[model samples]
Target: MRVLIVEDDAALAERLAALLGEAGLVAETVGDGREAAYLGCTEDYDAAVLDLGLPQLDGISVLRHWREAGRVFPVLILTGRGRWSDKLAGFGAGADDYLTKPFQHEEVVLRIKALLRRAGGHADPVLQAGDLSYDTFAGRFSLHGEPLALTAQEHRILAYLMHRKGAVVSRAEIGEHVYARDLEPDSNTVDVLVGRIRRKLPPGLLVTERGLGFRLVSEPEFRD
Candidate 1:
């Protein structure tokens, strides 16, 4: 999964990024809330870890702005505040989950996974696309009961596609979800990844539209 960390403390931000990366997630860190707000509104991140005290703009204000603008990605507030009113205010400001400072790294990762599970509409923790099954929290995939190993990027792409199954997702849409604010690589990156995914899939599942984009063909019959 892809995550954005909005924190001002350089050391803490780097630590969080490294921990998240070790847990098989693509993570990006920004130091200020203005940049956080802009990236949060434009990019397609699965979840965000935000600190309440941020420069340029407070994290609560950033959350309010994104909520007002109808941005729906799950957000987890990580701050030093530990009072009841602060927790209430964080939730009131649209945070899906809250974590206080001096927390266990494992707990933070677990909380983020829980928030993502709730947000993705897969309340059971397992995402299913016909006979294929993927455990969102565990980051494991299986086809017809056999385990399938996938690269981190492949897992992210497949999870995003499966979350929006039946929709015709354009290459640009996939790119935005995979790489947030990072400059676009060549145009064929999406195609190359899709090709790799197709080779791993059983017989006929993923479908490509002639001049459009790609879709996961869930029906029994396949389409070109």
Candidate 2:
């Protein structure tokens, strides 16, 4: 999972990034809210940790802007304010979860995971498609009770595909989801990754849509 941390405090941001990275999340930190808003709106992040007090633009404004723009990624508000009104305002501004300062690292991680779970439309961290399962938190994949070894990129690609399941995801969409903005865009990257995943997956699991894209079809389709 990729997370963007919008925080002005350099030390705190670094600490949060390190902790999130240790938890197997690709974390990027930005000190100002303008850049945060831009990235949060344009990029495909699994979640965001936003601070209310920010430079250029306040975090609440950023959150509102993203919400207004129809950005649906889950957000966790982190700030020094811990009052009832503040909490209410944060939720009113479209934050999925809230965390106050001086919090334990474990608590932060847990809250982020909870937010991700909710965003994924599943209460559990593991995403399932028939006999195949992928653990989002653990970054692992299994097929029919057997552990499947995968590279980090492969794991991310498969996880993204499995999350969408029956939906056909285009290569462009997959590229935007898996790679950050800095990476070079190649039209065939998603297809290549899908090919690799197909070789690893059990037979008849992944389906290609010719010129369209690919979909995870775990169960056999009924036809006349």
Candidate 3:
């Protein structure tokens, strides 16, 4: 999954980015709210961690702008504002969840995971599609009840697909969520990775729609 971290604290942002990355998410950190607003509108983030105190613009305004632009990614307010009113404002401004400062990094990861699961219409930490299952909390995948080993990139691709299972995901969309902003992947990168994943998956599970894109179907009959 992909997440945006909007925090003015450089050190804290870096730490959160590292922790989220370790949790199998492609995390991008932006210190300014204006930049955050722009990226949130333009990028395909699964979720975001936003701080109320941001440079150039406040977090509330940025979030409001994103919502106005119809960007529906789940956002968790991570600020030092612990008051109930502050939290109400955050929620009023379109935050999906709230976390105060001096929070545990692990909790942040868990909250992000929960937001992702909820956004994906999944209540449980373990997401299942046929014999393939992904434990979002454990950051592990299982096939036919056995552990599935995948490289970091492969894991990200599969996780993103699993979250949006049954929908055709374009390669460009995959690239945006799978890689960091600075790293521009080659045009064939997603095709190569998907091919690798297809080899590991059961036949007819991951289907290609030629000019369209790829979809992970729970049943073989759903394939195009």
Q: 2 or 3, which is superior by lDDT?
A: 3
Worst 10 residues of 2 by lDDT: 215-224
Off by over 4 Å in 1: 217-220
| Alpha-carbon local distance difference test for all models | 0.82, 0.82, 0.90
Could you give candidate 2's per-residue lDDT for residues 1-224 as a string of tens digits?
Answer: 67888999989888988887666566789999899989988888888999999999999999999999899899999999999999999899899999888788667777886677677677778888878987766657898889998776777678778767788988877777666667635867667878998888866688887788888875834333
TM-score of 1: 0.89
How many clashes does the backbone of model 3 have?
Answer: 0
The candidate that achieves the highest lDDT relative to the unseen native structure = 3
lDDT of predicted model 1: 0.82
In model 2, residue pairs whose N, Cα or C atoms come closer than 3 Å (at least 3 residues apart or on different chains), thus clashing, are: none
**Which runs of model 2 end up more than 4 angstroms from their true locations?**
22-24, 220-224
Q: Give the poorly placed runs of model 3, Cα more than 4 Å off.
A: 221-224
Put down candidate 3 lDDT per residue, 1-224, tens digits, no spaces.
78999999999999999999998998999999899999999888889999999989999999999999999999999998899999999999899999998899889999999999889888888988788999999999999999998999999999999889889999888888888877747759889999999999888889998898899887764533
Residue pairs that clash (backbone atoms under 3 angstroms), model 1? none
